[model samples]
Target: MSLVRKFMTVGGATLGSRIFGFARETLMAAALGTGPMADVFYAAFRFPNLFRRLFAEGAFNAAFVPLFSKEIEANGTDGAKRFSEEVFGVLFTVLLLITIVMELSMPLLVRFVIAPGFADDVEKSSLTVRMAMVMFPYLMCMSLTAMMSGMLNSLHHFFAAAVAPIFLNVVMIGALFYALYTGADPLTTAWYLSWGVLVAGILQLAVVYFGVIHAGMSIGLKFPRFTPNVKRLLILAVPAAITGGITQINQLIGQAIASAQEGAISALQYADRIYQLPLGVVGIAVGVVLLPELSRALKGGNLREAGNLQNRSIEFVLFLTIPAAFALWILSDEIIRVLYERGAFHAQNTAVVASILAIYGIGLPAFVLIKALQPGFYAREDTKMPMRFSAIAVTVNCALAITLFPHFGAPGIAVAEATAGWISTVLLFVTLLRRGHLAWDWALARRAALLVVAAAIMGGVLYYLRGVFAASLASGSPLLTKLGALGLLIGVSMIVYFAVAFLIGGADLGMIRRNMKRKASVEPPPPADL
Candidate 1:
């Protein structure tokens, strides 16, 4: 299959997950709002979620896939299977120890690392500690699931790993439905959500485990050993972990800082969920598919193919994300009001969340671009450089969040995250170019500039339409009226952007068909040493 086809396959599954994630967040808004319980739950959840990103999605896959692909190419399927089992044994053992330690230290973590702002509030801190303990085990399940996902992606089996996330949203949505049906209090509902997260992790792991098996790769358990391959993995993974989870690390810091305010943490989270749809679908699909493909291209000694893959992935990401960013920024208020301005989620909360969402929109392409760019280094087993760049980004994020949060509140944190993302993206791009690893695709550069213009044009249309449908999007409007208005706005914006993009030579069916029909364009073989 073509690169674009693989991206779509993974992206389509991710779209399902993101859609369910929207449902889950909507239910959560109605049930929890920005109340104390909402703050407690989100704060608790961010800790485990941060670790999950670092270990499962970020570090493991970045380090594992390339190495695993090399093993397959050099030593065949048996060699890869043995290597997987070795890593799994070590990973499982380490996770067990970490979970035990974390559960024991949950209170101290909440008081210090997770939410120092909750320290003075005895009740909130205690609740956060308990809830965090319940959810922290989720890190173990998800990390294991990530390992299996790496295996699946290497084997060109993208569906299961991509689809597995849907269960997390589905199970949580089910929990929310139950809480709503029972009219449970926020505290009880928060409890339900925490347990729901744990259950979902297990289910997700099971899903991917079966997927690995179906792909004809059976990995059996073994005792932990510090084998040479495992040692090499650790060397690569330690840095990749930091680089991979840079966004999460920044968000965790923001969460800690935001926890000082009453509703800041919850507000940032709601806004984050809004923008994550595009980021997850476009950014993640590109990252997941591009990394392994680049690894294979490089392994086969095809430099030009690797360069084309990088350029096209960036092109694909920008083509989708630029317009998405504009739509979100323009429709932020309307989207928040239509989705969350009911029950406990008041109009005041909508205003705050919408502003944050708009700022997040500004950074969407940067965030996704980081995804498209990072594989250039990871595919070559060069994890340390990205890790150094991530440190700079994180430092920038910390400084900005501290300076801005006091002045502008939650939206300030959004600004910091976006700025940091763009900085990291530029660093990666420039470094890759300087190292002669990434070639400048002038066609991609020109089209990206045009796509931005198309998005700006669409943004103007959305701005006018929002005023036209202001009444329908108002808090007092009926739910159906709000839904219809928002749907029409989105539908019209998509049409306008795509039409403008195609007509103005930004992108066309020809470009897309070429991408979808393209295969690895192999050039000269590498030197024997390489």
Candidate 2:
């Protein structure tokens, strides 16, 4: 597939997953609300999900993908298969051991690591511990799934791996429906969601495994062995893992701080669901597809090509993310009201969540820019710098969150997190610039400036339109009217932004159209014999 095609495939799948995620989260809000149960269930879910992201999505994949991609390019499919199987066996054994230990120590883990705020309430604490134990095995399942995804991504099979996350949303939504129909109590509902997470993990792993096997790559377990290759993988993976886990680690820190305030955890989560729509689709799609492409360019000694690739990736991230950040910042309240201010969710809950969502918007561009820039390090097997950047950012987050939390509550956590994100982004940019790995040409710089101006114009238009529709978006308005008003604002804002951008030469439909077709128009070279 062409690069743009690969990105769109993954982006399209992620957009699907995010839509399902909205459904799942909306149902969660209706069923649980911003109550103790909502806090408890999200807290329990966060524990296992933390490790799942750390091991699977964050560290291992960063370490694994480049190596796997290199293996594919160097030794063909057979060599890559041998390497993958060895890593899988060792990974499975280690994960199994960790899961057993954590499951056995569930209460202590929950008390100290996951959610200490719950310890004051015996009922809540016990429930969280139980649910955490039931869900802890998901770490093992998802870690395996991550490895499979890396393997498939290396083989250029992006669709199956990217779409796998929809499994979690689907299963969780179904569980919520079952809870509603059965008239389950809050704690019972939490149990259903917890088990749904584990089931989803297992199913997602199976889905990716099927993709690998169907590709005629049979991967059977071997005895755990740290071959030279395995040792090298670990050496690279450890820091990359830490670097990859920064976002989750900071999130855990935020939750730990938020847990002290009743309903604060749920507020953050509800806002996060909305924030992930842009970050997951545009930012993640670019980040994932760029690494392998950069690795190939650098490996072939194509520095100019790598520079151009990085430039385009950054442009794409900002092109999409900047406008999203502006809209999220401007219309967070209306968006929250239209989507979530119903059922068990109240106007007060919408206020807090909207504020947090707006704060998160401040970091949106930085978050995606970090994603775009980090591949400069990862593709070079220089994961340690990103780890250092993460370390600094996490320290900043903890310090700021603690200092700010006393008066501001959840918004304090959001502010701290966004600040830390910018710090990391700045550190990455400086490092890349110092190494002469990335630079901005005048056209790139000019366009970026113009895009910011266009976003401001769009934001102004949104504010004006919002005032005109203020009555329709009021708390007591009918759901359909609120939805229609919000939809109208969004449509007009997008139209204004693109039209202004095109007129000002910040963006060109012609260029985008050409770029999209550029990949499809080129014919592939015929395969060669060795």
Candidate 3:
């Protein structure tokens, strides 16, 4: 399949998952708001997610995909299958051990990580620690699930991996509803959410396992043994682990700082849910699909093709991301208010969350760009270069966080993160260019600049419309009126952006259409041998 279509297949599936996630977060906000319960739940959830990114998404996939793709190219199907089984056996054992250790140490982990926020409230701190313990085992299930996802992705079976997250959101939403109806206490509800996470992890694993099987790959555990390929995988994974860990550490630092300020962590999290929708759909989908394709191309000594792929992915990301960033910036408040201004969540909370959303919007494109760019290094198995650049970025993030948090509060932390993301993007781009691995095409740059101008115009129109509907939005009496106003704003923004983009030659609708058609006509890249 063509790159655009491949991206769409993955992105479309991710988009559905993100929409369900939005529903889940909305329900969660209404049920728990920015209270102690919300704080505890967010903290508990972050632990597993942080490690999952560090180990599974960052370390394992980064190492596995390229090596697995190479094995498929070099040795054929049965060889790749044997390699997979060996890797899986090792991963299973490692994760099981880590889960046990994490569960036992959950109290100490919570005390160190989230203690600043609960300094004055010992009771809440204790409850958060307990809840964290209930949730820590989720990391093991998700890590194994991620390994399965990596295997599926390598085979170009994007649907199952993409759809798995939807199941997670569905399970969480069900748990929230159950807690609401059962009249459970907030702490109990939080525990239920934690348990729901473990269940969802298992379900997601099952989904992907079947997807691999359906793709004609029979996967099963093998006796663990050290192999040359396994050693290579470990070597490649270490730098990626550090790189991914640095990014998460920056987030953990932000969380730690936010915890000191009442409701700050929850506010950051809520705004994050809003920004994450676009990030997950466009950024992650492109990154996941691009890496294996680029790796295989490079392994086959196709430098020009790999370069073309990189440029196209950049264009694809910027084309969608520029407007997404603008829309979120313009309509942050309206979106937040519409989705979350109910039950225990009040307008004041909405205002704070919206401000943070706007701040996050500033960095959205940069973050997505990093996702597109990093694969360039990873596909080449040069994880150390990106890791070095990430170390610098993380330091910059820490300094900014420390400098700004005292005066600007939560928004300051958001600004710090945004700044760090742009810095990292620039560093990655320059390094790639210096190494003669990536180059900027004039046509792409012109198109990107034009898209920015178009997005600005769209933003201006949405700003004006939002003001015109402000009174009804604030009155909050009629739900339909509020939703209608929001829908109108979104409609105008889309129309204005697309119209301006097309008219100004900022984007080629015909090219996009042709590309989509081409994507439909082509078959997927033949599955990797295993």
**Top candidate, metric lDDT:** 1
For 1-530, candidate 2 gives per-residue lDDT tens digits of 65667778889999999999999988888888899999988898888888887777876667888888888878988999999999999999999999999889999977887788887999888988888888889999999999988888777788888999999999999999999999998778888999999999899999999989877687898999999888888888888878887888898999988889999999999999999999999878887888878877776666777787787788788788888999999999999988898778999999999999999998999988887898899989898999999999999999999999999999999999999999999999888988999975788788899999999999999989989999999999998999899989999999999999999989987557634653322223445568
**Which residue ranges in model 3 land beyond 4 Å of their true spot?**
245-247, 509-530
Q: What is the lDDT of residue 371 in candidate 1?
A: 92
Per-residue accuracy of model 1 over 95-130 as CA lDDT, tens digit each: 999999999999999999989999999999999999
- Model 1 global lDDT (CA atoms, 0 to 1): 0.94
Give me the overall lDDT of model 2. 0.88
- The TM-score that candidate 3 achieves is 0.95
TM-score order, best first, reads: 1, 2, 3
Model 3: per-residue lDDT, tens digit, 1-530? 87888898989999999999899988888888998778877877888888888888888668888988888889887888888888988888888888888888877777787546776778878877777777767677777777778778888888898898898899999999999999887778888898898889888888888888887787788777778999888888888877756556677789888888877888889999999988889998888899988888888777777887888889888888898898888888888998899988998999899999998898999988988898899998989888888888888888999899999888888988898889989999999999999987898899899999999999889888889989867745477888888888888888999899989998897657644543222223445776
Better of 1 and 3 by lDDT: 1
Best candidate (score: TM-score): 1
